[model samples]
Target: MSTVPKREEVAKEFQWELEHIFESEKAWDQEYDQVKALIPQLAAFQGKLSSAAEVNKCFELEDTLSISLERLYVYANMRLHQNMANTKYQALSEKARKINVSASEALSFITPEILALTNDELDALINNEQLKKYRHSLEEMKRSKAHILTQAEEALMAQVSNISSSPNNIFSMLNNADMKFPKVKNEKGVEVELTHGTYIQFLESKNREVRQEAFKAVYATYGSLKNTLGATFSANVNKNLFYAKARKYDSVLDMYLYGDNVPTSVYTNLIDTIHENLPLMYRYMELRKKLLGVDELHMYDLFAPLVDEFDMNITYDQAKSIVEESLQPLGEQYLSVLKEGLNSGWIDVYENEGKRSGAYSWGAYGTHPYVLLNHNDNLNSMFTLTHEMGHALHSYHSDEAQNYRDAQYPIFLAEVASTLNEALLMDYLLKKSTDPKEKLYLLTYYADQFRTTVFRQTMFAEFEKIVHERTEQGESLTPEDLSSIYYDLNVLYYGKGVKVDEDIAMEWARIPHFYTSFYVYKYATGFSAATSFSKQILDEGEPAVERYLGFLKSGGSDYPIEILKRAGVDMSSPEPIQQAMSVFEDLISQMEELVK
Candidate 1:
């Protein structure tokens, strides 16, 4: 029986060393209490940020308190993620959550108070020696002056922040811990528990029946709870709309883009550009259907292997070495840091019962970043290793290079470093592949990333756009309405080359990214940007490597677009996406030629 292991069954070396965050639960509690105590100190400056001296003191205090609070929160929640059903860590996380809420409510007045000052006054404060370091953060607040509410209103908004997160919390609890799927039959004719982690694994099966069974089985479970999910998803969108309008943004998308200073055109243009070239997807799907020998390529066939009986089962240690080898173009210091993090307790490397599905690299500023991965040994897992370590290294570099206030990079730029890693890995692997079959498989894999990361995510971005816009216009959504929007998008993106399964309609209900408004578009944009950067690094060598490394270490020192602009990819223009599509075309053409 292939069963998932318990958390305790995982070896010490394989698990992350979260003790780096908090030494003990008792230590976590002590810091939690300490954070509570400092909340009052932060509140003490609520009305006193008018002077540069006062603003400096208050901002410094806020940074100190904020750092501690973040550490506490990150540690608690990460512990909970190790095993979500464990109530002991659940209570620990909730306690951290409450303090974070209290801290926000207590310190919420700072931004509004700063915005209340006249421009001349703010510039004078910025000119002050003590406040010079916070210029970027301060200027960002000034940029958002139009949206800053009254201090009282801001405090109320802070209070509401905790409540606003209820939809995500509810959805997560239900999805990760509460919801259950029936046992699914694998390619070997053995039954395995259908889980969020295993769903993708099953879909990659060469056996069509196994893939279809897993796909239908997974979505059927989601479809059964369509009403509840519909309500939950709708409520989340409504929550976004509520906050956007309250902050006086024209739309929820504006509110999201506002923080990173990313123009709405970037989001819309990504979708439009991809739409213009979706025939590329049709060609790929057409190829996929022929390759798989299926009459119609169904949703489950999305990840089916192009080459038969080609196994790239890379073990964890081998993945580490391969990832390290792949990143050689990045120079030595980068490799040294990566190697240390890879070997150290910086990663939680395997799937266990109740652990969160999917993978992410996350940490608070004062510590090294941590990655949560449900790593199944395969080619995809090797790519994931490179991808996530890309994130970890970005965090590691940012923290090392920037101050506490500036170390936190915005979400818009987060995927760039990670996807660039994947790009480099693909380049390394493709160049090093001597076998025709291996090279073909590698080419298809890269092609699929374009399909999934760029095209599929844009399809998702469009679904979010339509649903959120409709709801913003005061229309309500039901299960059927949500499903219809998603289904239509799949058809449009996939074209007539593939069968758009009805179960795919329920697909929207399972994506956790939907809960995070306007976030998925970055994956597409970032992939494009990273692809562009990889070309530069490969072609130009040392100079390009320096610029790219500078980008990684920049943290949140500048706006995401400006940072990328300095690094050579202008995301504001549609050229990067167009270029990325051109590369996608090359891959598809290569596949066609190789197959022939």
Candidate 2:
């Protein structure tokens, strides 16, 4: 039997491929020096951007500088992520970050200067042959021009960017570097220290007492820091409020939604729809309680494995095959790119000591989008593989289809492609599974996805809205205040079926996402849209597949909502969310039958 390798050993197995971004570290440093030297030239165009030709030339130069700088920055950061404890790489990465900030500050005046142009002048510039190449960029500038502050005010805002981002930075330092949990005995009677990395293993422990202890101990740590977390969250809310007020927006929500060209109704609709379907979620909890044979379902019992006697350990190779087969519906082009990404050095597969926890897909222009995963041999990791591959393929398609100016997609639609992969993978597994226990596990997992992606995220969205509104009205939130609000929301969602333990109230402190203003709602909305899109692809076949691929390739050429509509998902209506909830209802019914 093969045992799990130690984290340090794992890092040694896979050296990162920085050659994808730069030929060598020495070459990267040379380019970094060149970029630093070019910084002064950026200021030359700062005040001279009023002329149409000069503005066009300024944007072209800025884009070139941005591209080069991003390549260096991403390469350095990716190297640091591989082994964050390496002091050499860490210093280089920090230098890169500071360089990025300085470059951004230097180029900050470009937007305000363009905003200085009168509407007619901006239009003429857009129509001019010299500037027409940047029509999309110019149009976007014009759209946001109304909200652009005076040059001095814009400079003030730029100066505060570091301070404004401080809440998230503080949360990061505390959570990743300082947070600690109590050791608890596992099913094997082994005392394990509960760090962020080991909490999942403990949560999945088959032993009930072990799971409960781990859950309580983990949240207890968060609970201790609840006041500090609350203040940090309040600071983020104030940051959003400051920008919204400065920009003459109606509300923080309005300001956030405006960036994606979406409306406040979309956010509220998700909350309202999830609330209407609370009974379905409660049914899931009731079923979990019955199946687990527990008198009371504690918060820790939430992630307990439903199926025993099924050891479905998939190797990394096997997981790749499963993802490829599941995503084959998107056509050969999509499949081909995915296959290359997996086979090529596009993924940093598995974790190491000091490496970043969790997974993400990242790359700059002119590079294959690379994914970082802490792969374990399990069904969950398999799904994670497909989910991140979805992101990589989305990036691949967008880069292929659009110029750098319009290549980047918004965060609003980022999860749609990723979760759609999950939907597809879940469907594939369910159809292939034969054993009742295996089927039950898969179904339970799918139900949990709904609980998390839809119900929980909407709850978070509602919490964010309320917190922002309270702050806007001049009410300060203490840690106890946040805990109370969070606890009430949990009780409201879970109903009377599951016990909402006091420690669960400290969940707000543990969610790193709370530091991001009004962002959690996208997870809920994206899952809903994916549900609708996946169903259409499986049911409608070729046309739906074409449109979905088109959606992936659309990038920032259109507003996110409009792009979704072009792909056959009308998020403006509640139908897609309702459809997703109905799928949840069906899964609950299936799980109920299988358990019996």
lDDT tens digits, residue span 26-73, model 1: 988788778777788775777788988889898888889889988988
Query: Can you write out model 2's per-residue Cα lDDT over 1-596, one digit (the tens) per residue?
Result: 54645445764334446688898989998989999998888888867887887887788888888988889889988988887778988998999999999999999888877888899988888888887658888888888887888878987988999799999999999899988778889788988788898888888888878888888898878877877777777788888999999999999999989888898988888888888889998899999899888899888888887767467899988999988888877778788888889887888898767778789999988888999998899887898889998898898989889878888999899999999999999988898899888898789878888988889889999998888888889988888888889899999999899899998888888888888778899989999999988888888888999999999898887788999988888888788899898888889988888877
The prediction achieving the highest lDDT against the true structure is: 1
Candidate 2: worst-modelled 10 consecutive residues by lDDT: 7-16
The true-structure Cα RMSD of candidate 1 reads: 4.4
Q: Tell me the number of clashing residue pairs for each predicted model.
A: 0, 0
lDDT of 1 at 378: 96
TM-score of each: 0.83, 0.87
Clashing pairs in 1: none
Cα deviation in Å at residue 42, candidate 2? 3.1
- The lDDT values for all models are 0.89, 0.86
Q: Which ten residues in a row have the lowest lDDT in candidate 1?
A: 37-46
